[model samples]
Target: MPILQPIGRTLLIFFAAAGRLSMFAANGLSHCVRPPLYFRLIARQMIDIGYYSLPVVGLTAIFTGMVLALQSYTGFARFAAESAIPNVVVISITRELGPVLAGLMVAGRVGAAMAAEIGTMRVTEQIDALDTLATNPFKYLVAPRLIAGITTLPILVFIADIIGVFGGYVVSIYKLGFNPTTYLKNTVDFVQTEDVVSGLVKAAVFGFLITLMGCYHGYNSKGGAQGVGAATTNAVVSASILILCCNYFITEMFFAR
Candidate 1:
């Protein structure tokens, strides 16, 4: 009977999870369709998640671009192709590394924070309290975060692209002795609008994934501290995994054979 109970409980939890996710998706769609939008909350979240996160994202992008340039210069120099460094750096940053790294960083910072806050609210029944006060938790709690993520991530990614390109520029010019003008010219000529657009699109998708996973896990947390901790961990893990998987699909959409 004890063993049977465990299995039954597991099945019940799985079904609950599926139902919760479906409901969340439906509610999100409904809120988006309805009027009386919550712009203030969304703005606040944008400041918190997007603006505050800029320093870390910018720093990461700069260092990544610098390292990529350095490494590529070494390898390409071996083939007597050092002139390709600018093009390589630009393409790599704009297409792949910028969006992916920014998404990963936000997953660690914003995703975990969202999950913990919402999970704690759940455990304390504050979400229920909102309902009791005739407030919609979906509108009040979830909408802001989702909208902020969607709006602000692209901006952040844009900044990251600039910083990353400059990082590569510094590495190429100073360390590798490439002419700055030539390097900049090669980068400008090699990159396309499509490359930048593709990365921004990926950033938006990643933002949505990060917020969705955080809200889903946190809103459904159970028990007490242990459950909240689990939700936070799950939020980060799921957001990171989804970001990577979605990157492939988005890349295919942009550049598939």
Candidate 2:
């Protein structure tokens, strides 16, 4: 009975945490659709999440495509199948690497920032002050971030896809000595609409999850500065984990038999 008690307690804790997170997400999402939406706040968040995030996402995407092309060439050359590099690069970039890498990068940067900002508010009584002033904190803070995250991430992912494919094209033509025209043709012919659409869908889900984790952790934070720091760390880790997990399920849903 004593040993069973510990196991039971752990299970209870896990379920409780999950329940709290779900409720927080539901509450925040509900506010997103309700009246008194803040367009200015949404625009600010969009700039923060999208515009500011471009550099990291772009660098990560371009380098990923370049490395992918180089590695594919190295492997395919062994079988005299170097011609397939363009197809591989395009399909891989549009279908997987672009969305996943961009999501992870944004989760690290934007997610941590959200957590820190909101968590600081939580610790400093600013949220309570908002309540006194007749402002709904969730509606003002969480919804804008959520709306911006969902809307902006897809655009970033699409741009990343283009940049990634172009990186591959550069490597294939300039470094591998492949014919530029032939590489471009293969890339264009091999990629389908389904691949790009699936990637965009994943981006939306990843964005929502990233913001949810950040806001949830921040809103629930306690203690003080230490707690805000912990929330920031948890936000990044949780958002990253959710991105990878959701990516697999999304891919399975789109491509599985």
Candidate 3:
């Protein structure tokens, strides 16, 4: 009975947290649909989430592609399957690496920021002030972020796909001594629209999860500085975990023969 009690308590807490998150998500999404939409706030979030994030995401994608090409070549060389490197690189970048890596990078950078900012507002009573001032915090705060996240991550991942593929191209041709023309041909011929589309879909889902986690943690945060800090950490960690978990489910949905 004692052991069962602990297990039951854990399950209860889990369900409670899930329920709260669902409620928060519902409210945020509802606000997103019905609104005197804040285009200016959404635009600012877009710049913060997408444009400012480009350099880090681009660098990560390029280096990832280069490393993947090199590693694939090494593995395939044993079987003299080097010709498959280009196909492997392109398919990998478009189907998995680009979206997943970009999602993680953005989660770390943007999720933490969102949590910290909102948590600060929460702890400082600014959110309460919004209520007093007749401003709907959900619409003003959460919806714009949600909109920007959903809209921008796909664009970021698309650019990452290009940069990643280019990285592999550079490595294959310059470092591996492969014929540039043949590598490009294989890459072009092997990759399909579905691959890129699937990645973009994953990006959108990831974006939503990231913003959702950040907003949920921050909005619910209590205490003062310590609580805000904890929220920031939880936001990043939760978003990253959700990104990986969703990546698997999304991939299975898209490619599960």
Model 3, position 157, has a per-residue lDDT of 99
TM-score of 3: 0.99
Tens digits of per-residue lDDT for model 2, 127-151: 9999999999999889999999999
Task: Kindly list the per-residue Cα lDDT of model 1 for residues 1-257, writing each as its tens digit.
Answer: 88899899999999987798878967875775576678888888999888899999999999999999999988998899998988999999989899999999999999999999999999999999999999889888887788888778889999999999999999888988999889999999999999999999999999988998899899989999999999999999999999999999999999987
lDDT of each: 0.92, 0.94, 0.96
Model 2 accuracy (lDDT, Cα): 0.94
lDDT of 3 by residue, 1-257 (tens): 79899999999999999999999999999999995999999999999999999999999999999999999999999999999999999899999999999999999999999999999999999999999999999999999999999999999999999999999999999999999899999999999999999999999999999998888999989999999999999999999999999999999999999
Clashes of 2: 0
Q: For every model in order, what is the number of clashing pairs?
A: 0, 0, 0
lDDT, residue 36, model 1: 68
**Any runs in candidate 2 off by more than 4 Å, and if so which?**
none
Q: Model 1, stretches more than 4 Å misplaced?
A: 1-19
Answer with 1 or 3, whichever has the higher TM-score.
3
Q: TM per model?
A: 0.93, 0.98, 0.99
Better of 1 and 3 by lDDT: 3
